[model samples]
Target: MLGKKKPLIRGESAWHKGWKDLFPESYREVSFPDKLLGDLHRADIFTSCGTTLEFQNSPICLDELRSREAFYPKLVWVLNGKKFKGFKILKHLPDVDDPRLDPYDFCLGEHLSVYRRAELHSGAARPLNFYHPELRNIPFTSYYYSFCWKQPHRVWYEATCPIIVDLGGHFLYQLKQRPQLGESYPYLHMITKKAFVSQYL
Candidate 1:
């Protein structure tokens, strides 16, 4: 009993473990005991800046989502975008436009909160091809893109904190939801993984 092995946390995946490994050992799996709730909440990575990164790979109920947000005031959800099979990222907002759509609808893209006639691909294998070999090269800068998720987990929309998505690429996307006419619109900010990790370190 003195040298017992600890069991892996329930629902922990290799992707979760890999993200945790990037941080210092002390910052990983830091738990806070709450007297009022009579339960402990362990953050995947509690940064020195007092931000808790919660890596969510599965669908979470509204109750649990609100509870965690309340528990960790400075929380940022690091969602596993790969979990959603129907997630698709379209081209940058600037290059995409359809003559069929009205000005307002065209600007919003093919999103749930709005309707548009642009025939975006159901499934996109890569991020927007902003670069072309024939064209002169310019340093790449991060840009926001409109996305279409088949059945997105809307629970995250109610969250007060920031939500960063891991799309398994050279970059991590920060999901920003803007409220327009009492509806939530989704957009992704393309950021380099190195830049994101550096802030925590």
Candidate 2:
């Protein structure tokens, strides 16, 4: 557990106050891996706040904000093995002209602003399913799960599953069935890994 102390403010701008105000309780300046930060930027879901709450990062990309319905705030929580460390808060649509701030920076906001999906997908097709044998103890009508692909560049998807408890049942279950070929999953499909680098690299 992180020590119960205030985080050291680093950035030397007015925004530092905003960061302090956003997370007034407990904060710390822990160094994180740059590669991990890059991944979060690509996913558009990392936040300044450390791991603890669900609204640690934003899930939407800047390019997708043109759509009226795409303006909701999203969170992305990155897990390093079993421990959760880094996060980013994307609150709103960013000003396009600002050179100092990337579109990724403006994605922070309240957690409730984001949408929650119950099914994980690869593009338009569902790529996976989840089953938890311990769902009976959870209070929600559903639970959230994360999905990733074997190949890099493939986008991840998340979905929730309904929880049903029977008397004396001790298991909560979720399934991640792989999507069939030729189906549209949550992310775009392309040529194999070798083919991609051969053409681009």
Candidate 3:
């Protein structure tokens, strides 16, 4: 079993503090050695329950994020501490047969994920667009959602099951509405907070 883990305190950043406060049992700033995962990588927040949470505030290339999400048993939860963007909980399963070690092939691999057919975890027929001056030349990019594209350095993005979520306020609470169960393949869908409260509350 993993030992008692604590988050690295560079300073009291509110986002970090929020997660640490909410899930005190999770280990913070975790690193997986080379090839143990696909590559040497670090997770901001991880739990023994088989999920890893990635936090985003700055602009990062989507390809990089997509590659990273596949390494977990259930890398659920894209958490945003800021109120502008809410949080999303993804239903994830690694494409690899085993997670404790890399595939014996020791080369690159593709991932497969699916969603709850009822929605909140389904696929998007449209390609979600995102804009950054840096993104102008990038192919297949048509950044959507003007509300989230307010300005640079203030937005966050998470691609769940291939659906893009530009979260808004009360993100943690948004996750309480569990999405419907579906097949396991890569896709992203979101559930309504109201649906969750009515069903589980």
Candidate 4:
């Protein structure tokens, strides 16, 4: 019963020379230590959201640090799981080496896709009767159960908690621990799906 949306795909752009012109005015005066800049220059790719930056090489960039300042100042708030505007805007660039050309992927779908999949896999199962220690801590059970029972209203409420609490918890932890590194979508997708299964179904 769920609808599927097409994925958004973007290609990499040409490399730019200086941080001074590329970043916002606020970041003009900021300086990257020489070692970090050297690493960035060697990287095969660079990708960033307003709040996070990922590089293929060992070096980090000054823009990434500044992006964190704008998007993740509090460090605890969950960023809305939305696509970055830069992904689409940068897609318009003609040059392949444009900084915005970093390859990126986005899947389009409603939040309930995960919840619905869990429900399908847990047909006719009673709530809390299943024994799975790994899933005991996940908070999406209520939503999954509601969907299984054909109760759409309950599904909405239950779905939101797990999506926020379970996903947000791990997301923040990862950002805090690995702020400079970028994650591939497939890896994150698998982790999120597995977490949803563990918590609810």
TM-score, per-candidate, Cα-based:
0.73, 0.16, 0.39, 0.17
lDDT-wise, the better of 2 and 4 is 2
lDDT for predicted candidate 4 compared with the true structure: 0.24
> Runs in model 4 with CA error above 4 Å?
1-14, 18-26, 32-118, 123-201
Q: Which tens-of-lDDT digit does each residue in 1-201 have in candidate 1?
A: 497544556778888888888899899999999999799999999999999999988889999998999999799889999888678887554322223213222234463223222323333222222233421132323376778877878887777888889989889988886543324456788889899999989
Best by lDDT: 1
Candidate 3 C-alpha error for residue 77, in Å: 4.2
lDDT, ranked from best to worst:
1, 3, 2, 4
Better of 1 and 3 by TM-score: 1
Residue 41's lDDT in candidate 1? 90
Greater-TM-score candidate between 2 and 4: 4
Off by over 4 Å in 2: 1-11, 21-26, 35-201
Q: Give the alpha carbon lDDT tens digit for every residue of 104-162 in model 4.
A: 21112221211122333446322321123523333431111111112122222221111
Stretches of candidate 1 off by over 4 Å are 1-10, 94-142
Superposed Cα deviation of residue 162, candidate 2 (Å): 23
Candidate numbers sorted by TM-score from highest down:
1, 3, 4, 2
lDDT of 3 at 150: 28
TM-score of 1: 0.73
Pick the winner on TM-score between candidates 2 and 3. Answer: 3
Q: Which is the better candidate, 3 or 4, if ranked by lDDT?
A: 3
RMSD to native for every prediction? 8.6, 20.5, 16.6, 20.5
Q: For each predicted model, how many residue pairs clash, with residues at least 3 apart or on different chains?
A: 0, 47, 19, 10
Give one digit per residue, the lDDT tens place, for model 2 in 56-125: 1223343333221122233222212111123221222222223322211111122211111222132332
Candidate 3, residue 89: Cα displacement in angstroms equals: 18
